[model samples]
Each structure stands twice: as structure tokens, then as C-alpha cells.
Target: MNMMVPPPSHSSLYYCFQILLALVLFSLQMLTHQLEASSSKVEVLPGFEGPLPFQLETGYVGLGETDDDMQVFYYFIKSENDPKKDPLMLWLTGGPGCSSFSGLVFQIGPVEFEIKEYNGSVPSLVLRPQSWTKLCSIIFVDLPLGTGFSYAKNLTAHRSDWKLVHHTHQFLRKWLIDHPEFLSNEFYFGADSYSGIPVPAIVQEISNGNEEGLQPSINLQGYLLGNPITTRREKNDQIPYAHGMGLISDELYKSLQKNCKEEYIDVDSRNELCLRDLEYFDECLSGINHFYILDSYCESDSPLWRRSLTHELKKSSSSHLTDTVPELSCRIYSSYLGRKWINNERVRKALHIREGTIGKWVRCYKTDFEYEISDSVEFHANLSKKGYRSLIYSGDHDILVPFMSTQAWIRALNYSIVDDWRLWFANGQVGGYTRTYSNRMTFATVKGSGHMAPEYTPEQCFSMFTKWISNLPL
Candidate 1:
């Protein structure tokens, strides 16, 4: 038997090499076909600012169902001031249904439009230049099969989380496949609420490369979560923490604090006072609206048009007709049209939420949303482990997905710190605080803002992104 084994060595090696070559050739054939179907051109233009040149172009992906493949409408805006100097940002909006284009126009786009007073109707809102687009090329994406102008070929394949992830994966994969050029750009993915899942999941998927040993790949630089809700278990545990932090109300806070203390049978921990203060702060948040947390609009002699239009902006009696939620208000004012301007059908179909339901309606067409807070925490952990950059910025007054939730999430990371945490002060206001964990995950808060932090404080958001893109070490 020993003599036989020695005799087979050279022949076995040659046979193995033949098999490997065949597998490699097969993979190359498959990838070449996929690449051929996906290739497209991206348009680049000189940026108004002297930054890198700017590029904007749209791309679509076919979901592959005989009946209906998902279609993604996406645009990549990149800065080209210096070929070696610009970064790429991928921006998605929450609602699992909201349009990223809406965010671009109303919140962080290159323009802002103000609603006119006196129901003037014609040219109701005037356009104002925004400051964020000056720094980075923003890629606005409409996803999940049914969001905005993006659509699926049929109804049967719609509204699945697995599909959501898969379709997005296919779309983005093809996008890069088409461009192939921007794959090396420093890229970050960010969105609010449910996008918390897709954004991180996609990143992890790309990193896995392929369990099937496929060759198509994505190179992601880092991740940024604006208001991510990843785990239900951790979310429930943190509810009290969220309440303690002023994201909810005192009554809700008191109930949870008492319940947790008794149930856990220990209240003397060093975190007790911090928990108590957090509870107290959160109690006040319940009263805050889903929109318009800014008190400036209510102050008399306020420079905002809302004040000028109201007989008593201070009197909570703002007109219901003209004063719908700020999001809708922006739409009406900008389009110079009535409810007709709102994308009602798309919103209803995409989010799985019925038309015209008030309150924070971010229902995903995926899972029942048992809480993926753990996944979010895990995402931050992995980023820190790989020595990559990440930023978690929250709106101080967002009644929906309160800033308190974000604070609790970070505290739970238990990361070791290089720099003792300190509040980041700006213009006499605590813009936010910076904490460097031994691993490099930095968490910050946007002072005096709501869920739409960038929309409210574009300059600060831009500054944060700019600094992050520089890849500066903590």
C-alpha cells in the first residue's frame, strides 16, 4: 500500500490542478455574463464648489422574476474636485417606503423651498440653496421594490424582507458592476430607522464575499447609522433607558424604572442616577411632535414663515389646513400644488402602511420587526474590530426613535476608551459629544434637532461627514 501511494502522487496533483482550472473558468464565464448585462455610464460634471468634480447618473436593476423583477432608481453624486480627494456617500430614507429623492429635495439636497404666507398659492415656496451638497456627492436611492418610482414587475414577489435585501443586493451589485470604476471610492451607507437593517446587512453580505464561492464582490469603507433600531430584545431592555434619557415622558419613565428596579431586585448600581436622569428627560419627549420640535417657529418675531403666517404662532392653535406636518408642508409649498403633489399611492404601497395614517408610520414590508437592536450593536462592534470609521448621530428631540435609544445603544457596547468622553461644544451649544472606544466607534448627538438632523442642521451634518471622510483617527 505504501508503494502504491507514492506511485499516485504526480498523477493526483495533475488531476487536482485540472479540476481547479475548470472551476475557475466556470466562475469567470458566469461573472463575465453578469458584467456585460450591467455595464452603464455615469455622468460627471464640474462641482460648483472647487472640490472634486461632481458626477450624477441613474441606474436600474432587474429583480429577475419572469413576472416582475424589482427596479431600483438610483443616482450617484460624487465630488471630483481632486481625482484623489473625494468620498462617496450612499443616502437612503426610512419608511422602508420613503423616497431618498424626497430627502434630497426637502432636507439635504442642494436646494430648500420655503412656503409662502397668506395662501398666495402661486410660487408658494421659494427655493433656498442648501449647504451640504457643497461638500459631498450624495447618492440618493429608492429601494425595496415598491419605493418611490422604483417598482417590481408583479405583485406576487413584492413585500418580502429577504427579497428586500436580495433585490437591493442585486441592484447595488449591478450598479458597481456597471460602473466598476467607483468600486474603490471611500463609501459609507446611512439611513434612518428600518434602513438600519438593510444598510448593515448589505455591508456584512458584501464582506462575506460568497459562501457559494462566487467572485462578485463589494468593497465598503464604513457605515453611518442615523437612527437605527436593530434589536427587539435590546430595544425592550433599553426602553427604560430611553425613557430615562428624555426621549419619552416622565410617567412612562417612572413606571419602567420602578418595574425594572423591582424585577431586577437591584437599584444601587452606579448607573442608577444616570438611569433616573435619563428617565426624567425621556418623559418630556412624549409631548414632542413627530415634527416641528423646534421652538423657534413658535417664538414671536420668529424669522420663519410659519410664524409670519400664524396670527399667534405661540398659541398652539396653528391652522390645520396650512400647517400639516412639516414633511407634507414642504411638499405643498415646493410643488405649488395641493395634496395632488404628494406621492400617496407609492407611500401606501411601498411602506405597507395605509394612506393618510397619522403618527410615525415606518412599517417595513419585511418581518414583524421583533427588534434587531442586537444586530445594530453587532454592526458597530464589527466596524470597531476592523478599525473602520462609524458615526451614530441622533436628533436630540426626535420623539420618534428618540436620541435616548442611540445613547443606550452606545453605552451597551462596553468598548474600551482611548479618549475620555467629552461633550463636543459648538457656538455655545453642545453640538454633540465625542467618545473614542479603544476600538474607534464614535457616537455623537445633534443638539436641538429632530429625527431629521441633517435637514435641520445641514451644516453640522456636512461638517461631520466631511471630517469622517477625511479618515482622521480618533
Candidate 2:
């Protein structure tokens, strides 16, 4: 054997080369994974004239098992002021089914629809001067499932608030894992409307996860809510709110208080007097736009509002009866423009949306989306005890979720008032009133604004937001 081992065999050399090649390929693959973890790039949106004037990245974060088709879609806009150092807000719009794009264009995002004309083509985009992106990086997400560009492999994956909270918690963890660079940035959970019900729960989950030593911790510092629905009892405040605004006579309001016992929601079936008062109350508000009593009621044909018909039946029917009231339907035209713009084939490609994934894009989805957990008032109380910073604002003119109701809940929190109610100045005038609580919670109202504060009072909202987030008085 020692005499002539045939020196070395070509077969052995070939085997060694194969092993080396495999190792090299595996190493390259690992490098690729790392690169993809932070794979955000500048976007070139279709409706916009040139390349996106600001940095925007669109991506999907998978939920549940890899094989499970639950995925959440998101639009991340890097902070124009300082992406690296600025806070990161996870902004969830109301409607529970409203697309994140609604927030993007209508509320806080950098661009808005330039509704100059509607020729059955995609609507042009224009820069929003008061975009929240100027102060903090924003992650606008289509939550739950079946919203915006987000879709689940199975329709059954559509979730209610209970499951939605867990999924959203998982989404935040996974998103941070992929974009680790933002893990250290100050984080806040911002939501409005019905999203108010889930944002607190989601924050609580994140807090619990961090406590359990979860991977990729979130640097959650606080949260933001505007015109939020904090409890099911929110409807109970309508009569009082109506009376305060002088929409109803004192006698009618007193009759309601005596008959309804301040419980408009879930009225006792046996209370005939209460029912009669409610009937009269309904008649009085029939023609008023609950969203903004000052603004004319605008009828919308969008599927979102159509689905919401049941919820708005009382208001709609009332509005219909009052033919004398003025009609200003600008919001309807805006909704039509957005729907057309998003559903375009070219626009889909520009946004990197997968074809056949979503059916139609509406500003807000219908109630077909289930919600298992309804109330999150306790979650808010728990979060308040944790010493987290909070900012809750409402549109003073909004009758939908009246500012008075919001004030009621804040008072219920039992936190001692740190700063007594006072006018918050913006643009050298009184923008709204604000009160600070001992637990770092601040409640402010945007004067002359509606349910969607940012949309109605962008400049004042921006000023208040910038000041509050900067730890300055609003």
C-alpha cells in the first residue's frame, strides 16, 4: 500500500471541489439574507410626476407560520427631518378596514390626491406640506387581513380585534427583525377612529412581549390617538353633546336624560318613554352631519360608506328627510378619485403590489371584517399605569365621537391633572384646549376640526403634533 497509492485520484479531487463550492454558495446565500433584512429602497410611484419626492418603501411582513398566507402590507416613509434619530410611529387608521393609503393621502402621509380633474384616469399626486413624515418615520399598515394590498390565502383569516392584536404584535416584531436599523428609534403606536379599540391592546402585547424577553425588542415610548372610540358607551354621549351644541332644546335634552338615564346605547326595551325620547332625538339630528355639524352632509357611493350604511342609517335617513340642508359632496368626489387611482394597473405595478392578490381597493372596507374583541377600555387603563407617554386629541367640532366623550374617558382614568385645562396656541392663536395628566398623558382638541382632525386642520395638527412629540407644551 505504501509503495504505490496511485499518488492522488482525480475522483477525490473532484469531491473536495464540490464540497468547497457548496460552502461558498451557502455563504453567499447568508449574505443575501442579511442584505434583504434591510432591503428598503426609494420608490417611484406612478401617479406622482417624478420619482417619489420623498423616501418611501413598500413591503410585506408575513404573519403566523411561513406556509400560512397571513401577510400585512405596509408603507414606510423615512423621516424627512432625521430618519436615523427621529421617532418611528406605527400609524393605524380607523375603520379597522380603512386602507393605510387613506392615512397616507388624507391624513398624515407625504402625498395627497390632486383632485383637479377626474377623466377616468389615475389622479395626480401632490406633496403635503404638513405631512407627519417631516418629524418621524411612519409605518402605515393595512391591518388585520383583506385590507388595501394585504390579503390572506384563506378568507377565514380575516380577524377580529382579539386575533388582530396578536397578529399586529407579531407583525411589529417581524418588521423590526427585518428592519433592525429602526429597533433603536423611539417608537409610538398611533391610531384613530375604531383603531382606538385595538391600538391599546397591541401596545399592551408589545409591552408584555418585551417583558418576556421577546426577540427584537420594540423601543415603544408612547402612543397617539385622535378622535378615537375608546368604549362602546361612546354613543351614550350623543344627546349631551347635541344639547351642549344647542342642536336640541333644553327640554328635549332634559326629557332624554330623565327617560334614558344617560344610557342611549342598549336602551332597555321596556322603557317606552326612553324609546320615545330617543326617537325624537334621532329626528332632531336627522339632517346634521355627525362627522362635523358645521359641514354639510356629503353622500358617498364608495363601497366603504355603503357598507357602513347600517351604522349610519339613522343619520342618513335623517339627512334624507331634511332636503333643505345644503349638500357639499367634496369628500365623495375625493373618495372616487382615490378608488380609481389605486385600482389602476400601472399604479399597482409602481407600488410593487402583487396582481390578483387584492380585489378592489376602497378607502374603507365594510364590516364583513369581523371583530372578536370589542372593548379595550381596560387596556388603556393598564397602559396608563405603566408610565408610558400618551397623546389623545379630538376634533372639537366632531359629533361622531364627541370631544366631550373623549374628555369623559380621560377623566375616568383617575390620573391627577398635572396641567389644568388651558388653551394651546398654534399659529399665534388658540388652536385648541389641552390638559396634562400626572401619568404623562395629554388630551388636546383641534378647534373647528371634524372626526379626522389631521384632514380638517392639518396646519394646527402638525404644529400640535410637532410640539407634543418634541416634549414641548401644546
* Steric clash pairs (candidate 2): 286-318
lDDT (Cα) of model 1: 0.52
Among the numbered candidates, top TM-score falls to 2
RMSD of 2: 5.7
Model 2 / residue 170 / CA error / Å? 0.9
CA lDDT, candidate 2, residue 421: 94
Model 1, position 165, has a per-residue lDDT of 57
Residue-level lDDT of model 2, residues 358-393, one tens digit each, is 876755555455655567778888988898999999
Candidate RMSDs in order? 14.4, 5.7
Could you give candidate 1's per-residue lDDT for residues 1-474 as a string of tens digits? 456445667889999999999999999877545422332333321112232233445544555643124556665555535433456567877655555765665566653444544243222223334434555556677766556546555534565444555566666666666656666666566676556656667666655554444445555677787755554232333445445555567665666556454232233457565456444544454344443355333222122211111112112222222434344333223432322223334423322322332232221222221222235567666666666667777766654455665667677878777767677754456666666666666777777766667777765666665666676532
Q: Tell me the lDDT of model 1 at 29.
A: 74
Candidate 1 residues lying further than 4 Å off, grouped into runs, are 1-55, 65-68, 83-85, 117-132, 210-216, 233-256, 259-287, 295-375, 425-430
